[model samples]
Target: MAKTVNIEDAVSYFDTEVLHSGAWDEADDALRQKALNNAERILYRTYGKTYDIDDSSKWMPEEAVYEQALWMLRQDDAVQKTELGQVGVSVSGISVQMAGKPQYIAPEARRIIAEDGGSSPRSKWTVI
Candidate 1:
């Protein structure tokens, strides 16, 4: 999937501290683009293909959408870190405090998207 948000836009949406912490570094262009692509895919899958990334008026404001995109990007990063053994690693028999579960899209982001009038419609029904 093509990226819906660019790095500059994402940086604007995220905080300075966040960008500087290496959690979502602006210098990591490849990772940033990968995250944006992942985020776009998640949004497209969740909200359906009707979402027009080119049409700004069809969805939430740029900031809100980018915020969700950043969340998705961060989530992917966290998952990747976990998969690569970068997370929950400890040395010298010391315990390490781990971060929270990695989520594709946070509850707040969901609410924001939902409130923007996006819906996940079901085309098929199953009866038991």
Candidate 2:
């Protein structure tokens, strides 16, 4: 879990005050630690095979999906944009693959099968 402190009052980026927290620090470490401890405790709680979010038959309440989502969102890097540009994938000039002909024989019938050939008759048929 990410340790979220009151970074608003931070003096400097290299401030040791955040690392070696003191009593004068405005942020409440005890209250924050309590929540972290509770979260860790909740994660270790046992689960049953018959558990359901909607079912009212369980002993313990359903696990909070929103809390899990919040935890995942916080784990990702805050920086959406960066100075360096991303690289592109390397591929040879070009290559095309062909599909085999159909088994059934029909008069005046011709088909142009694409690389990603599909069996669905939606485009092949003109229904009235």
Q: In every candidate, how many clashes are there? A: 0, 0
Off by over 4 Å in 1: 1-3, 16-22, 54-57, 76-103, 120-128
Instruction: Give the per-residue Cα lDDT of candidate 1 at 95.
Output: 59
Give per-residue lDDT, candidate 1, residue 15. 58
Q: Model 2 clash pairs?
A: none
Residue 22's C-alpha lDDT in candidate 2?
32
What is the lDDT for 20 in model 2? 34
Q: Candidate 2 residues 42-123, lDDT tens each?
A: 3223222323223444322211221222232233122111112222223495543323432221111112111113122224
Top candidate when judged by lDDT against the true structure: 1
lDDT of 1: 0.59
Q: Candidate 1, which ten residues in sequence have the lowest lDDT sum?
A: 17-26
Candidate 1 lDDT at 9 equals: 65
